[model samples]
Target chain A: MAALKDIIARDYGTPAVVIDLDIVTHNIARLQAACEARGLENRPHIKTHKSPELAAMQREAGAAGITCQKLGEAEIMADAGFDDILISYNLIGEEKIARLAALIPRARIIVAADNPVAVDAYAEAAKRAGKPLEVIIECDTGRKRAGVESVADAIALAERIKASPQLRFAGFMLYNPEDAVAQTQAFLDEALAGIRGLGLEASIISTGGTPNLSNLGRIRGTTEHRAGTYIFNDRMMLACGAAELADCALHVYTTVVSRAGPERGILDAGSKTLTSDIGGLDGHGLIREFPQARIARFAEEHGFLDLSASSRKPAIGDVVRVIPNHVCVVVNMVDRLIAVRGDEVVGEIPVAARGRIV
Target chain B: MAALKDIIARDYGTPAVVIDLDIVTHNIARLQAACEARGLENRPHIKTHKSPELAAMQREAGAAGITCQKLGEAEIMADAGFDDILISYNLIGEEKIARLAALIPRARIIVAADNPVAVDAYAEAAKRAGKPLEVIIECDTGRKRAGVESVADAIALAERIKASPQLRFAGFMLYNPEDAVAQTQAFLDEALAGIRGLGLEASIISTGGTPNLSNLGRIRGTTEHRAGTYIFNDRMMLACGAAELADCALHVYTTVVSRAGPERGILDAGSKTLTSDIGGLDGHGLIREFPQARIARFAEEHGFLDLSASSRKPAIGDVVRVIPNHVCVVVNMVDRLIAVRGDEVVGEIPVAARGRIV
Candidate 1:
């Protein structure tokens, strides 16, 4: 059998996805170690990678539970035997309520709610399932995406859930968008005080991100931290002061197929392998080991590389590894990822939760 | 027997991909008619939808041939009996070369080359197969992505292919990235003149994009024009003055899962459905009938929606149909699209050619 790179260049197929298992294992170990040092439980969200196999590895390396954003993701995780999973998003409707009821029998699924409607849905689902489901009042400490802005709103929702025999009041949950450790720590400190003063027993204070994972000292009040992309930090994380490029494990292996212009060369991997994530420190993610090459445009299966002045031009069959701006999005695009370590094919893991956008 | 939306919503399948097949078919027919009126042959590229079923529809509707960017996409088309398919991308490697050679026996396939190294690879593949392969020299008229810059380089490549008994020079191919119709027409005119001055028949002066299709008051001196996204013009094109929003047939079905804050509402569809195509008009794309909702941040499975202050708030359980910013990228993310016709379930088309990142 051919080794990893040789097979990847040939039978691994074109526009295929390859994951370095060793690198991924290293990332898992590193993150788990970091969370453990501060006596914080690591609940890595499945959203970043959305792989059940990867989640199993994280659990093996000592994760308290798994975090999921959607009910679909939670369903997938629960089916895969993940009993302690957190569906960290607002739940609604009869269809979703039914699915949540079905999930309660299989796992310890906790959901986040910031409003009465969501709390009502949880209550109805829990009552239907004949179980008291855990509910965490989500706070908009920062990152104005969702969650209650003030503590009063959070308390009101918590009280409503408390009124229901079907619900159990958990602690508050938040996502800090800031990347710097010091700033994230300071922000979390005041938010913790405010939540604690609510007179409700806020058990688990969850706060974690790939950017703020390393500087988690300031978040001493955090009972648990949630970080996912840290397992496979991409170029975006490297640029955002989250992690170094050396720590990034997942990379898109592409081939230079066209080099007819002075300023541009074309790669087989386009927006499919490398999705458009332009918010990274660099315009696009760093072109690993190819400082001269910059991704200018993405046309689905075609990536336009600006390498006009490079002395060395990649031939038609030359292989190039690209570290995407955001690793999470890249991993989300493929159907499966081949996990390899050197010449040996460690495993062929299906991106099982792929297309689980619901 | 229920409609697509009814079946999916009843199942509470969050974050669904919906396609108006009637609108798609209508769009295809309308665009083909326009191209035919302009005296141009339409070779629809498969990158937009990445569905062999859709490609077959285009071929059935009198498309001269199909255009694809990857070998995998071309192979899928070939399997679907699209014999006269053009792999409008650079063919590379022993594996790809071998695949290219094998495909020649099954379909009338033509591969593009922009460099001499690639020229040699094609020569070797054809020689190995003992089958003469057609070649198109990709010319970068103004896109700055691929293709030779000057006419001298074009002639030089033509000479190389003509010299090789295994290779046959078909013509020239250029993909201009100009947003205006007039600019692309002018660019094509100049490139055509340059190719003609060399005494070479530029049979396939292939240029395709949503913006360039309607801009053609008259056809350039090229035999065929290619376009993919014209079948379903995306938010980018709609914003770029290319196509109207009515021409857009693809959308994401999402529910207002959470309304935690006054300025923030969360939709089940996120970056995974929208595919993070920023810098377009309206920030992201038009949200079906709700023209007021702006996509704040796309979090994998959750689309952060912030409605216009003037528009009514989306209540929990209320569904929103979102027109994606980039349909091509969005198509690659899903496994199947519910093909509908006026709220009726027409068919369930499997996106067979998706995840072909190589």
Candidate 2:
């Protein structure tokens, strides 16, 4: 076991992030095919991988466009030549709106605003831009994160957008968290009816979360969907019964740095890499192929793994792979990632939007 | 209240990581002063705020040196001309050891190895580098993270280090997560006594954790103490009664992007910015001045806040200040930070070690 560990270690090494590009491409195709099969557009949210390279792959896979949550993220995508992008999340403020206005001239930009105040803010910005800004009325679909309460609320917001010369109503967007497939579709159907019944065009009904995507075809009236974390399914997805462990593509490659006791050892990666996001899971993350090894604690630089529950006693210098609870948070932490295939270092991807936290 | 929020927003805007440099400098001085007053050397861990500029500031504030958990972080410090540094975590594998060996000649390199396997690995690297590597035995001081368990264990490890020509025994490094001050000294003292009882030199007694800093003065015969989160006191520190809100220097500047229901609104800064580090805390982060606004949910790019409890509604474009549960994680998420002084942008500091997760 030690020799095997060393061999694998020498091949991939420690303190590296390994991504199975094959799995990523597979996920892209599966997601795109699922959405297109449902007669909906698949606007791959670049926010997940935040890689123009990956976004291009999604575009090549028949994606209608890309979705961005931040203007910063959108700016990066636009710069990467992904012109048709949807700012899925809410956009606010003069600084952000000004950026949005500038982006509109170059890219086909659409955004969401859930309230009259935000609608007015966008209208004023659009008036300054001297063009109707594309707007999506957000609908609350049980997640309670954002969006208006019902179709009436959404229509009221859309009507406000329609009244404003600075803004044009485009569609609706809702993100449900770890939602069951049936529940998400039901909520979307209910919300969309109210919007479409208003005699206004709610052409775009966007809804996507990995858990809900398994039955995306069953959902009625959703013309497009946005799901990000599906590119690299994490422990949370596995825990939620959304993805299989074998489907996970990203892992924090950590070396056993310490054997504090027979029961305890420290891994090179910590909250800085695995992240402090439990994502409602039992522990920080799932130690790939080392289920019994519990993540007992996390310092900024080292993760303490209690391996007594497991039958194996891992020696120091052994490389362990950790599938983080939330893949997206882990992605934002690194400067670059080592792309590997079966212990071979083939290439490196500069985490282009690694720290576009703004 | 709206005026105050607007003042804060206009004065301190969104997508910005606000660190009152003045407060930071004071906090550094305060910690140094405390450590000095306790007759202990302060080796502030560079992990909390991975900025070499801040490390230099800490050194200038009377820190004996800086402690880094990663070799990459150590390299960043060395690049900043910081010589006397401690790579507090373990050095593993030939490649990492080779990197460590290369760094040893450039800086006063001190590393820890808790197991025989890792110790020998470092020893071989040190021998190859022709530089004496100071090795500290990490003791599992109630944290259960890393370190030797008993006096016998400590003595055995110290003897092993003494036997290796490349590895020099340099006291002990105990990461006391549970109770750094209370339990650390007794356990460390016993271990050191047992090591000295074995006729081996037990010199430096280092222990740390931001939470235990207040009781640090109680620990006797402790030569040096290391702490990182003390500089940028987080919500966790505040929750643990370790630091005050005023002591917290890092805050994420965000804006209210969408208001759905009466009480619900979405914040621009989410998991990607503030991170999903609940860390035994109730919410994602503290709303700094707005204690009533509860961050109920956090997406990768949006934080859902329930603002119904507040006296007034946080309109779109209005900025809100959030003190993250873990400031360290948030700092690692961004590349460059805009330092401001009352709406005036003072300067932009590159997060020198921003993505050194590896």
lDDT of 2 by residue, A206-313 (tens): 876777776575556678888888988998888877789768988877888777677777788887777777777677777765789998778777788888898977
Candidate 1 chain A, poorest ten consecutive residues by summed lDDT: A179-188
i-RMSD of all predictions: 2.0, 2.6
The positional error of residue B286 in candidate 1, measured at the CA in angstroms, is 1.1
- Give the CAPRI class of candidate 1: medium
For candidate 2, lDDT tens digit of each residue in B1-358? 3453454454434667877776787789898989998899999998888888888899888888889877888989998899888777767777776777788888888887677776887788888889898888887767677677776777887888888888888888877664456667778778767777667775677877788686675767778889999888998999898889778877787887777677887888887888776778787887865788888778777888877687766776667788899988888887766565444556767788876755
lDDT of 1 by residue, A1-358 (tens): 1245567878775556667778888889988888888888999988877889999999999999999987878888988999998888888777889989999879898999878888998999999899889998777766766677775676677678768899988877878666444554554455555555655577788886778775664555678888988888887677777777667777777887777665577788877778777764444545665767778777666788777656666666667777788878888888777777755667777777887767
Q: What is the DockQ of each candidate?
A: 0.62, 0.60
Deviation in angstroms for A111 in model 2? 1.0
Q: What TM-score would candidate 2 get against the native?
A: 0.93
Error of 1 at B153 (Å): 1.2
